[model samples]
Target: MRRSKTILLSLSAAVFITGCSIKPEPLLPKDIKSSVKKDLQLLSNIVKPITKAITLEEAIDRAVNNNIRNRVQKMESALAYKQIDMVYYDMLPSLAANAGYSVRDNYAASASTSFTNGQPDQISGTPSYSVSQDKERTTTDVSFNWNILDFGLSYVRAKQQSDKYLMAKENEKKVTQNIIQEVRRTYYQTVSADALLKRIVPMKDEVKDALVQSRKVKLQRVSSPMEALSYQRELLEVLRSLQSLERNLMNAKLELSELMGLKPGTKFELSEKVRKNYDLPEIKMALEDMEKVALENRPEVLESRYKERISSKETTTAILKMLPGINLNAGINYNDSDYLLNNDWASYGASVSWNLINIFKGNTYNKIAKTQIELAKEQKLAVSMAVLSQVHLSIVNFKQAKKEYELSKEYLDVAEEIFNLTEVGNDLNMNSRLVFIKEKLNYILSTLRHSSSYANVQNSYGRIFASLGTYSDMKKEEVKAKKVEKKLVKKIMPAVEKKEMKSPTFKTYGIATSNLNVRAEASLDSEVKYVLEKNKKVEILKTISIKNDVWSKIEDGYVSSTFLEIQTTEVK
Candidate 1:
């Protein structure tokens, strides 16, 4: 009764302490200010400086290396792998060691009576009392326990978690593919805007001035009211289009900056060659091969396969849980007691336990396991169908993008001729500029359309690559660049590089830029083995960087990777 009162009082004290401690606590303004300050500092320090104009290859590398989304996916995969370790530990036997000290106001006492023929007799000395325990004592217990049924269930669960880690990796791959697609689309748009913004800005200024003057002319009645109104209306339409186009171009710059994981309003440049010209990506792989590889590398399909494995293992777990549990326990114990004969002891035993209630629920558990397996299978089938549809749609869209780009190119050619003819006739002046502004607007509009069409073609091309799930080329360049100083960089033209001491599993190819030199070694001074004329296809063995320049090892010699396209290839 005394011990029960102590325990109740302790519980009440704990409740009182908890009640005293509890209160609504939110971030004060000062705390929020500090947090924001730290975050801003981290953002500024995290990104590498844009040392030079970024190429398409370099931009993709930055997105992969510095983008928070990619970093989070990688960390999540690492976390899942660590969780597998946690699950494996669950299969291990539990061991516990506990030592306790206690004090009491009175000793543990007991008295006994003996009876013979229904008559009770007390021992000599009247008030009989015996004490076996002291008021203060210490105890130590070390125990080991293992349950066979629980171990089996934990082992099955560990297997499922192992597959979950692999699924995380597959999801990471999917995120990387999407990032690459986004990089390609934005990189070109940024480049085109950089080149055309100069023309756009001047043209916009002139139109704004023209609109202001025309409004003044309308107010002064310098011309017929209808003519002046019509002129002002034309100027307004031109100004609106110019402003809209400029806004879009500016938006493209910001989007590219963000995609490359740079700070807002960060200044950077793109390579001169790419800024001045559009390098169309080419995929020479057969459609059937493309489809075949898509099945092999697509993250959705791989993740689905892992889910099927997990579901199968879960059924095993269900069955393991229904069996009888056999618990094995062993312990060593020690205690200090003045009246005890032995102060230390060792014990070991096993106990088998069965839950009779679970026997009746066996059928229900089996049905649930079976249903989980079916769901996994159905989901796998759905993912496969979706992947196939994406690959086919990407190809069709790519072709249409190319056709549209070609048509835009033709229109640009005609517009260029008209602009040149007007310039040759000296038909442009402050007064006539507004009269010819429509002609100039058509020409500039054609230029923007041509640039946009090509960017779309590039975007569609990258989408097909992303859908097919090929990032080997980009990954190799990032690694190769890191070998120089251990960061994602491709200051030299980025090309796919892999070690090839022996024949590789698949063939990779590249095209020559103008006249390419195949050197005896990866250096400018090395003897030229042969020259590859412009646009000749070369089978790439591997690529490596010496200093900052990159070189691709062809069948017999090395060629500079600066002029070669890396991301698109025939994977056979």
Candidate 2:
């Protein structure tokens, strides 16, 4: 019987535990439906059984929509939005529902049998006995509270949350812009590298042909062994350069793919070539115009502005701390000696509270908030200066790069003409091998310079657009420059603008005149100045300062018009 009773007690205990335990509800199917659908779509896109080349824009779109980092930013923005909602809701009355049950058993003597005051005389003559009984009880309650008046704390908190949401939204935009820029930059770099590899392939073939011809001449006793060895060394050098270029090209492509947030080991083929065919924008306005654009469009500048606004709100909130807070609480409670609804009882009441003594503590936060506003102001000034400098530098680089590209094209044409004449002279046995090789080297150097100059122009444009936060607009403006006619008085140049000018007679000077010595001279307008310096035996003259110092001309003839500071020192 005792064993049976023990099993029965264990069963009762298990039931009681199970009844008191809370079970969490399963996630609703609709909760994750959107996420599941998105994942499936991404999987389908990536696993599609076709090999189609994706454009840079398409890649960037896919990355922004599906990339982990971007998705995280989006989620953070959403969370901030929810937080703002929560803060607003804090100002409203809250309602809550609660229910519970309990059971208990007590072993004690009944009070009815122990109390016999009138029968004391009979009780004294006979022994008194009391019967024991068991008692059981259970109860449950529900309650809620809401702040009635908090001295604008709720409103200030909501405003702060709203600012946070705005900041997060701006942060999301910043991340997206950064991702797009990275994708575009890496895509262009890969395309450029590929173009360079294509250019090097023919050069490598030419070196191989020259090596073979030199070896044949050596066997025929027409060329010395030393000459053949020189050809071989030249071929080896060409091959090494080719290999390095190829490796770099591959690395660039891989990097681009990675930036697009592609899976590891995925291959990407650029659909377009990195040709230097884009026309420069007609930027007639001064550097100040570009700086304005940067200030308005740059994400960092906008973010800083938002931060300053947030700090202002925070200062107001801190000052409002001097006021006392008042809260109201009201709730309904029920109690019962049994778990039956009929035996239960209910009660409700309201109360208010405040912290009047804490107003003296508000001064500390107010002072801190004032300090924060000053810090924000300083930060804004620093960012404005930095943005101005960046815009100025980018403009100067664009001008100088355009010039170098034009010069490189002219140099390439001259080198090609010299190489053609040298080839003819070599065939007629009038040109020595050394002379032919020198001409070949010049031709190769010119080609390299042309490629480098083209790359520089493209990079400068990229930087300019990047600073303006509009690099994505380049997709619509790619075009090649037109060829111009060459005349005695007006040289119409290819890849450069044509202008009419007087042709001066060429005269040799024994020594360059000191009048050509360009020094940093302030113009009649003190804001404008000119500077000159000699480098690598070449004299370079530059306008060091404009009315507003829009651009700086470097010794290399490259002009950097962006607002970036140029380090200058007194010439010894």
Candidate 3:
């Protein structure tokens, strides 16, 4: 009894010391950490403004790397790998170690006691108090268990998880291809709209001025009423068309900004000259051959095939679940109860168990698994057919777009010629100013149409690549290098060109990583006196370190160094 008390006191004191040394549980749930981190990131993005002019290649890179949908797909692929790890671990035997203590409400006692040497130890037939086994006991156990059926099921699950990971990768590729397609299409449209607007704006202003002048002449009776009204109506029609084009221009720019992960209304210039000669390259593959390649490479088809494989595995898993399983168990136990004959013991055994009831019910599960496998196969076939159709339709559309673009070029050329002739006639007093203006409007409209047609042709080409499931293979550097080589060969020029430019002399410069607040003071908590746009270059006068972060003093104010990157540039 004294030894038992000593052990109990020692254990209690150790537990008390350990409990005091350990940190308390978190006040908030552990899951909130991810949410908090994500929220901070979101806040940072919201405060940042995009200030760089993104190139085509840069835009595609950003879309693939930073777009939320693509990020989610990447996370899903990571999650699938984690799941495979979990299921694989489940296939291993389970091992557990545990310790426990228990005490009765009242001390365990017996109703009978040893007889004493008196006439009668009390009432002979009456019960007497007696000591019993220890009322409090402590137990320590270590156990290992393995069930064959569980391990088999876990193996199947692990295989399915691996397939899911592959499917996720394929899905991400599909998404990337789709995003690239959208980026290319929207970029072309945005650039075309910008070019069209440049032409439309001046023409629109001229038409407006003409209408105003014509109204004045009509009011003075200097111009014929019918002629004035007809000219005015024509100008109105041109203005309406210009207004519609302007609306489309805004929408296209907005969409391009969104795809490039820039804020809406962000403005930048495009290299329109590169788009002037986007003709379809020669196609040597036959339609049937293209279809075969698409079937073999398309992500959707591949994903469907993986799904079918997973379904088949699931069927095997279900069958295994219904089979009798052999379970092997081993344990070591320690007990501190006085009543126990053996205080420490080790046990090892194996047993086989079968759920007899599942024999009747498992048929339902088997049918379900079989049906799922069939469904997966059917879906795969459907995807294959759809992919073939997409390939054929894309080819037809590419051909049509090419034809239309070529015809538009011819139309634009004719319109330009007519406009030039009208100008000559007006100079010779053979045509009215109104006729010149009208012909000029026609030429501009033709130019716009041609530009739009060119964009359509490019889009059709992109669609063809997308249909082939091979758009991702198109490298931007190759295309850019080709364009550069052509330009260099065609237009050799001197290195020093005449230009009116300003060069700022600075000790050093820093590039802003976000829309940093340029405060009058160095502290971030200070008032935001001015906001520096993200990715903008600022001349740094000096830098000072506070804690682990640095603050840069610019010409205007101070900004955090954490958001600035030093840059070197040459002054001509």
Residue-by-residue lDDT tens digits, candidate 2, 210-283: 66766777788776778667766765675676667567666877776656666656765777553323344445
lDDT of 3 by residue, 59-175 (tens): 667667666667778888888878888889999999999999987646777674447775435545766667646778899999999998999888888898899999999998898
* CA lDDT scores, all candidates in order: 0.76, 0.59, 0.74
Error of 3 at 383 (Å): 1.7
Best candidate, TM-score? 1
RMSD of 3: 21.2
Deviation in angstroms for 75 in model 1?
1.0
Those runs of model 2 whose alpha carbons end farther than 4 Å from true positions after fitting are 1-72, 107-136, 149-152, 202-228, 260-278, 319-323, 338-346, 352-357, 422-449, 469-572
Per-residue lDDT of model 1, residues 1-572, tens digit only: 78879998999999999999999999899999999999988888788888887877888889989888899999999999999999999999999999999987777888878898898886667667889889999999999999999999898888889999999999998998888888878887886787667677777777787778777777887778888777778878988888888888888879888877888978888873222134455667798888888888889999999999888876677677679999999999999987788899999999999997787787788888888889999998898889889989998998999888889878876775454333222223334556557667787777778878878987887777677777775345334432123343222101101112212223456687689988999999999988888888887766565655768788889988877754323236
Question: Residue 509's C-alpha lDDT in candidate 3?
Answer: 73
User: Against the true structure, candidate 3 has what lDDT?
Assistant: 0.74
Which stretches of candidate 3 lie above 4 Å from their native place?
1-55, 103-105, 110-125, 129-136, 221-233, 265-267, 274-279, 339-341, 362-364, 427-435, 476-572
